[model samples]
Target: MTIWLHSEVGHNQDAKKEVKAFNSEDVFTTPKPERLLERILILATNPGDLVLDSFLGSGTTAAVAHKMGRRWIGIELGEHCHTHCIPRLRKVIDGEDPGGITKAVGWKGGGGFRYYRLGPSLIVKDEWGNPIINPEFNAAMLAEAMCKLEGFRYAPSEDIYWIHGKSTETDFIYVTTQFMSKQMLARLSDEVGSERSLLICCSAFRCDPSQFPNLTIKKIPKAVLQKCEWGHDDYSLEVKNLPAAPPTLEQEEPDDRPANSRRKSGKGKPRQASLFDMGGDQ
Candidate 1:
């Protein structure tokens, strides 16, 4: 068995020092030490492995993962995502952060990360209590949302207006908030050709369903309402809005063995979890 001393893996106090070094004015209340994360990563992963932290409090996991040369994704709901996480990660990328396992891992830091914000819910109720597509969503956003509902991959074609997404090489989806007339449908049907199939989603359409065998026409809001939950937005897993109680630390008996007495194991390759897999669980 191997032993990890505070000197090797660090403790909460060390985490405080690291956060304070980056943001002295507003330190995270409960942060994990970077050395602790380093040890976890060293055991569980290798360079280029993806690391994911769902409840990324102060972005310690991401920062440490980046320093250790692992790809990382961090999800945060609170405002600290803008304040603390972004700045701390910028320092890590620019090789400005010298604290934590930066020295031990020799992390000179050269990497980048993408940030994406979730848009508002797609379906909302109108004044008459009928389900309608949320006005907050623009054309592109509506197209993407419809693609997901219909089990199609959201990839808008650069050359074709009718191709918003695809289910197969021959099957495609088109989304528009405009009212589609029979003439418009005929034009689209002609353009789509006989070999390829297209799923047309619109606000309203005046066309016979049997006329276009290659095109499957569907109306927005109505077509998607039965597929997914509507008008509910709070997706957090927290049971309550109350502040979490302070953690109680367990007292341990004093160690009689020397601090240098510890065991190290050789690196092993374990299957790493993807960010998508982690997100799906949540």
Candidate 2:
């Protein structure tokens, strides 16, 4: 019942307007991904069940739900409101056309969703237009920011996969993009870090080796960056050659419906989950 795709778009710099990579006919730069909607629906709800998308990027969730015959509502606050969300959702409702996944899922498509926009990113500020700093930030504040920016959630007690003696709740980490000071590190480690954890660095290395006897340092993607020109775009054929967008594909209906239900042509019957997994909310 559910699936997901990445959030991205393929814009034509020359045109300034391009359909998204998944559904070229339905455009959105930061689409939430129809597959994510599919997976969510498959696990959480059934046909006629209601769904909600708080950060409705390009209304991908709404579109997927509509095509699946589910009632859905979306909340978003960004350029997508008109430039992307509305159009993408319209395409879904009309079952106009789409790429691979929707077609594969067999969406016969006759449903709709409601859209709404709330405010803005909580990290932003109002009229003064200046970023509000946490004057009294503690370990938690630093942890959350560091995690959010890096696409990881900060946790003080969880140990991630560092290859050294240090242990705490973290996978791999770095100081914030703005600052990577020892003071921040000390706070994160709860101060007395006689033994440092594994460290990965993109630039020059710092910190006294004696101070962190337990630390392990590993360079990442070692040769990938070195082989390419520094600091500029490196659209290697590996990535640049991806399909312009998902193929202009529509889903195919399964042939298992009963003849009486044939009058319905389809049922947005949400999918079932795999045996080994719990189908956690996407």
Candidate 3:
């Protein structure tokens, strides 16, 4: 396996280019391909097995999957799906990395991605500029929104990000942006924490008695508001102007599968997720 550090290849240039990219909002976000791929590979599949990324972004998952000897299916929405996503994946697949550094950083070249995309967000906004969230805020949306703010990939297995506490034994966290009401707190205090537990979590806002003994709640992250991208008639920023690259099959068949399968036919290497995921989940 060829390992190339992105810093050496200068690929993080893309990441550095827009340290403030989230400040306003472009159309779509190009997930730190390496970072997100690292997390996805961790939570999802084992090498040589199939991997799926609903949000292809700049084709990071595809590139990583190929390099790690895994077959991947990706879905994306935006123009980059064709221009940015396809081209990037192709570069890695053909071992024609111009980034130069990823290759040197141990990036073993190989593999490819099949892109995909879904339709626009389900909710509809009105004249006054208020977002009309679909019937309810589902777990996926909440997870994504939380990740967008925290600058991390949304992971199902990893719950609870401890923000800060007033003291060594006390702490709080902004779990989900969905406003955390008092009733919810009572329930969580019962389950998420105990009389001795030092952690507390809340959503967008906390409207409850502050003297709840061992529990504390705070508003959702302020950066979430600053970093959000609003859309037409929507209050909370929308991921507008993004290259709507819906997921589509770029490659024709899955040839790599047979090869990796045959090579490790007897080793019985238990499937493993990406190494990066552990950092985020824990």
Candidate 4:
């Protein structure tokens, strides 16, 4: 038996034409050919396989993947994501778009996808180098995040405010902002019993470790200090304006400090910033 291999399925002009048809104007300067993506999809994946496009320029990959009966995720940081890609995908879902590889794949679409924006950062650092949870997080969100960080299941107990979560029936975790005194620690240790162990995470603790063998005490802020960025809330990928530099050499040397002293003090000329920006969860 013999098999003949065929390649070069799509032309660049076809891609341009498809974009013009869908967008009513050729907005994308370099749109990808749907037929090219279709060929790649056919070669590399089976139906229902997952496809991910990190830079979904014109939504060609996602559209092709959707038409091919594959689940797909596409991420784009630019405003065109909302202006172009989303509308095009919505049209594809409603079976209104007849361009691209739709006819070739026999696509009369009936699929849906939900859109979501990245929320605030979970943790951030304060000026004092202490880790603080984001104010945007509610009690439930905080508990969930703590459970994930500590490798415990999020199962808050209704009867016990101290029991925020657990790793096992005999091993439990508690999260709080209040300081735990030695008397309070003793009471919790007694409640946990000999067979069980308890881990308490709080702002501060006045108990001695030797007194409670079964109770593990951890101080917050210090414990999670190096875990993540403490106070940064926004994770959006947007360009930022920077401070302008002094125009002339005299303006640069406004102060009476010597040039060598300025250099030693780490006050050099302004450095060029990075062009590419990225954020949010991947």
Error of 4 at 210 (Å): 13
Error of 3 at 238 (Å): 20
Residue-level lDDT tens digits of model 4 in 1-282: 133232355677778777776676547778878888998899889997768788998889998998998877798988878777888888888898899889988999777776756556766667886557667877777766666556566789999888887764556778877789988999988887776667777779885766887777777666566544444787543324432332343555454543222221112332222111111121
Best first by lDDT, ranked? 1, 4, 3, 2
Residues 233-262 of candidate 1: C-alpha lDDT, one tens digit per residue: 775644355233222223323334321121
Compute the lDDT of residue 23 as modeled in candidate 3.
Answer: 25
Q: Write the per-residue lDDT of candidate 3 for residues 1-282, one digit (tens) a residue.
A: 256465432345454342222222333354563544554565577776656666777666666676666666677766767766666667666666534235534665554433324424534454675544433546566445444333333333344443321111122223444565678666655653432222232345555545344454434433344445545474542335422222222432332333212221111222122322212121
Best by lDDT: 1
Q: Which stretches of candidate 4 lie over 4 Å from their true place?
A: 1-8, 20-22, 128-130, 135-282
Alpha-carbon deviation at 175 in model 3, angstroms: 5.9
Worst 10 residues of 4 by lDDT: 273-282
Model 1 spans > 4 angstroms off: 1-4, 124-132, 144-173, 178-181, 191-199, 204-210, 213-218, 221-282
Per-candidate RMSD, Å: 17.0, 19.3, 19.2, 18.8
Better of 1 and 2 by TM-score: 1
C-alpha TM-scores of all predictions: 0.64, 0.33, 0.32, 0.53
Q: How many collisions between residues are there in candidate 1?
A: 0
lDDT of 2 by residue, 36-96 (tens): 5566677778976656676877666666676776766677777656776676666665666
Model 2 TM-score (2 dp): 0.33
Predicted structure with the largest TM-score when compared to the true one: 1
